[model samples]
Target chain A: MERWQVVTVVVAGYLLLTLLIGLFAGRRVSASVAGYVAADRQFGLLAQYFVTGAMIFSAFAFLGGPGWAYAQGAAVFYILSYGVLGIAPWYVLGPKAGRLGRRLGFVTQAQLVAGRFPSRSLSLLLALLSVAAFVPYIMLQMSGAGIVFRAVTDGHVPFWLGAAVSYLVVLVYVLFGGVAAVGWTNVFQGIIMMSVAWGLGLYIPIHLYGGVGAMFERIADARPELLTLPGLNAGGEPWSWGAYSSAILASALGFTLWPHLFMKSYTSRDDDTLRRTVILFPTFQLFLIPIFLVGFAGVLYPSPPEAPDFIMPHMILQTGLPALVVGLFCAGALSASMSTGDALMHAAASIAVEDGVRPYVRLTDAQQRLLMRALVVVVGAVAYYFAIVQKQTLVFLLLTAYGLVDQLAPPVYAALFWKRATTPGVLAGLAAGIGADLFFFWQRDLRPFDLHEGILGALANTLVLVVVSLFTAPQPEAHATVYVEPEEEAAGATVEAVA
Target chain B: MRARTARRLAIAFFALYALVLTYPGVLPFNRIRPLVFGLPFIMFWVALWVALAGVTLWLTHLAARRERRGR
Candidate 1:
């Protein structure tokens, strides 16, 4: 068989397995809101760990990790910084969120914030913003799947078709099983990705440069700057330590605010489980080092006349490895993309249902499940459209999503930790941060003080939140207290309190 | 305190150490050469941190089990 033919069969077989797993997981779904959204909060530590890991690994790990490593050299360390700073805050915040989620039966982050502030409109607005942010993020994952398919198949199966095939598998299972399907499938995909990543990380460098150290030495001899911190383009006015550090900080702080990640906190069995997952998350980060090595190898071997994102895939293809090994590598990349896509698809659907639809219409348990399934298809379709239309570098698209979605952090942080944080304050902060981020991103000439656009936006957002919240009366303690109490305790309360 | 809570705290501390020790910019040294496990000093340190996380979790689970029996 031709290489592309082999690639098609392997990728198709992988998708079939994902579909099978999704269908199988449908048996576990309970016929209630909890079952549809949070897997009835029964996910064990291992399951939660894998799902969280897979959620983050996404296309960024497969494509952006190596792409940045190849293009920017040592500056790619900023990517690693995220895992460190990101999970620490989650140890405290995620448990609190989880506890509250259990107490209030909240399905989405917007619901949590809205419930805390006693503002239905704010929840609806956040839902809208989350969907907008998630669409671009989902697009990046779909586009990544497209890139992988195109590369492996030598363009025989076009990007859209490849994306469609994988997404079809995801939609089939997710539509039936909901969060159960997403969580279980993520476990399978996460294992495949981590195993393949470590195997490739060790094997590729050894095959290329006799050993890992030798690979570094070869790159050092050829282009010494590639191995050093601050990287080659440092003196260029566009990049700086201030910009890099601030960007890393913003990414770490804002990471938990993503609606999908927030939802994961709700799925944990308890506070301890959430904490354990955060602690073990670095093991996932350790796997990325070898993936980064593939990009470093690119410094020794020049990229062909194609996109820079193609460098890692091309390196894997040209490694003279067996066809099965190459197929497995493709599967790993696919796993990364699909795992992320499934989570985003589920989150987007839940946001639409719980936050978007619930306020307007009284939805029964069965009706909510039906609505979630339909919304999954809708979210997938929107993302598929962007994947087909917008073909940009994965890094650029990802950074833009990171910058925009990060605006949610101020409100999220305030809701959890600050009692004085009011609805109007959150609204003002979100507006300022999102507006500044978009302005700076679109009009590059207008970036104030040579900082990352995200930093400026975050600062403006924080300032508004502080000033506005100080002036505004404190939110009713009754509104916020519901979230902090245990579920059984809160369950005894009258419906009027929740309403 | 519940054994589970203690175990969780241990895991959190281990994760915190790994976060600080492995961060690229935070680390003061570059290319410390006397290797462990055929990896660089920094990589070795990180691997130990990862292992420590696992060990801490195991210990915490044991403590939690013992506490449960006492209760």
Candidate 2:
């Protein structure tokens, strides 16, 4: 077989394997809503680890991560910084969320928030924001898949066909399995992702530049600026501290706020499962060291790919490695893309039914499941269309979504931790934060010092939430206590936790 | 509760992270000339803290375990 043929056959086999896993994982699923969305809350610690880890490490981390390292230099550290900073809060917050999930029978983030701050409009608004944020994110995964297919096939697979074909695999499994499929598939893919990341992250530098230290030595000697702090601008000059600082802050806040990851908190079987997930998450963050190394290895190569996002695939193709390894690299990248896309497709569909349409109309469990299944196709269709045509940088597109989702942080944090925050306070804050974010996003002028728009929005949102809650009547004390200190705290505490 | 103490420790841990990983806390380590692990000093500095953040959180995890035992 020809080299590309070998690559194609290997990649095709990997996709088929993924679909089979998704199809079979659902056999154990319950017919009830909880089973579909939260995996019957049966995921043990290991499953919980991979599910949450896979949810966070998406196409952006796979492709855009290397892209940032190759394209933006020191700015890539922001990715590393935020993943840890983002989840560290979860160590404290994740158990509270898990407890509340069980006690109130809440699975989605908006459900929890609206439960605390009672409003149909609030539910609908959050649903809209989450779906809006999710589409681009899913688009990110889709396009990341497209990039892999296009690169690996040497343009035989066009961007549109690659994205469509890849997401079809994602849609089928997600539609059938729901969160169970998302969990199992992540386990299967997470194994591939880490191995591929380490192998290539180490191999590329060693292959081209002798070693990672040797590669950095060359880059430092040639383009000293790429090695320093305060990162490079799009123009390749020094980036401002305000931009650097806020990007880290905004990303960290946005991490736990994502609709899918927040929902995954409910899937954890116990508090220790949630706590252990946070502690182990940083090791996954270690994967970035290799990812960035892979990108940095591209720095001094003669004839790098025109677009920085294409650097890794371009390097893989250019290198004369065995075709099987090339195919595995393609599969690894696909793993990165599909693992997150499945979660996103499932989350978007779940939100559309549970939070978006539920308050307006009642539906039976069977009916809601049907709607979510259909919406998976609908959301998948929209993201696929955008992925085929959209021209934005994959990492930047993901960041834009993160900025918008960042608005959810204050309201979510308030719901879990604060006793006094009111419904109007949370609602008004959402409006203010999202409004400011949209306006600044369109205008493109920094408020000053180049702080990211999301950081500015978060500040505005928090201010409004606090001030409005003080003036407005608080959520009823009895209602607030359910969240503030749940009735079943003892029951929720694991023996390992309480012993 | 022990959960509350664990929560406080986690908060303090993240604060220390924010200090080391951002802005002025990271300001001192920004240099290209000194290389660690074949990484530029700034890159190595960030990588070091990334490793440290894991260690710190693991310690907090242990502390929580200790608190649980005490309870």
Candidate 3:
């Protein structure tokens, strides 16, 4: 067979395998809303481990990670620094949230927070913000997939067709199986992504530059700036320490609060499973080391990719590796894109129906499930449209999304940890935080020391939450105790905490 | 270790980890030469901290488990 044709066959086989696994995984869950949204809360440690890890290592990490390393230098280290910082908190918060999820039958993050605050507006606001943040993120993933397909196929598969075909598979599995499909598919995709990353990451440097150390040595000799911290900005100018540091802080803080990831707190079977997942996250996180190495491998190459994000696929094609390896690389890239896309679509839809629509409009479980499935398709189509048609640089939207989600941190901490946090306090804080974040985001020149807007927003949000809570009447003692101490604490010594 | 102590230690460890990796704390270690594990010093520094975070978490997990058993 011709080379591209053989690669096409391999990719086709991989997609078919993912589709079958997703369809079969769907059969494992019940028909209830919990079953669809939280996989019946039955995922063990292994499933939880992969689901969380794979969801975090999105197309952005796979493609943009290398892109950042190749173009922006040590700017990519910010990505490396943030994962463990973000997930370690989950060791405590996940189980606490899980206990509440079981007690109150909450399926989404908004439900958990609003269950404490008890505000319809809060729930609607969270749902809208999550969906809005999700659209650009999902668009990034879709375009990431399109970029890989177009690169690997030598333009035979256009960006639109590649994205549509791949995401159509994602839609089928997600619509059919819900979170269960996402979990199972992530396991399969996670393995592929890690293995491909390590294989190529090590092989490329060794193949081109003799060894990993040797590659860095050459770059240090030639382009010394790329080897240092804070690295370079998008315009290839030296990056500010303020930008670099705040990116890590803001991303780490906002990491678990992303609606898609936060909802995973409701999926684990037990507290131990949740705790172990957090412990093992660092191992999965180390995968970025190889990812960055691959980008560094591209630094001194003769031919440049059309864009920085295309460096990985471009390098693979240029190296003239066997078609099978190229095809597998394509599959790995798709895995990164699809794994996260499925989770985002599933969470956005669930949040929309459960927290957004269900609060104002009462719906039966059957109706809720139907509406969520419909919303999934709607969200997918919208993102796909932006991915193929507009093809806008979504960096602005992605940053704004993180800043917006970071605003959720105060409300969440208030709900689970602080006894005196009033609903009005949480609401007011969210508005102020988002407002400050947007203001700084637009007026970059006014930012103090080039700090990320998310960091500024978080500070504003926390300050408002505290001050407003002090001014407002505390939640009624009896109602607040359910969240502050919980009824189980009265019965015996329990380790329930949100620390 | 007591459960509360374990939790407190874990919190302190992470707090330190975050502090050490950001801005001024990271400035000292952010260099190109003196590669460790065939990686840049700054990159390796971040990875070392991440590994330590895992160990700290495991220790805390063990402490919490012991507390549960004692209860």
TM-scores, each model vs. reference = 0.88, 0.96, 0.97
Candidate 1 residue A76 C-alpha distance from true site, Å: 1.4
Best by DockQ: 3
Question: What is each predicted model's overall lDDT from 0 to 1?
Answer: 0.77, 0.87, 0.90
Candidate 2 regions exceeding 4 Å error are A487-499, B1-9
lDDT ranking from best candidate downward: 3, 2, 1
Judge the docking of candidate 1 as incorrect, acceptable, medium or high.
Answer: incorrect
lDDT for A232 in candidate 3 is 94
Q: Count the backbone clashes (under 3 Å) in each candidate.
A: 0, 1, 0
Top candidate, metric lDDT: 3
Q: Please list the residue runs of candidate 1 whose C-alpha ends up more than 4 Å from where it truly belongs after superposition.
A: A232-238, A302-305, A482-499, B1-71
Cα misplacement distance, residue A73 of candidate 3 (Å) = 0.4
TM-score of chain A of 3: 0.97
Model 1 TM-score is: 0.88
Write one digit per residue (lDDT tens) for candidate 3, span A108-205. 99998999899999999999989988988999999999999999998999889999999999999999999999999999999999999999989999
**Candidate 1: Cα lDDT at A205:** 83
TM-score of every candidate's chain A: 0.94, 0.97, 0.97
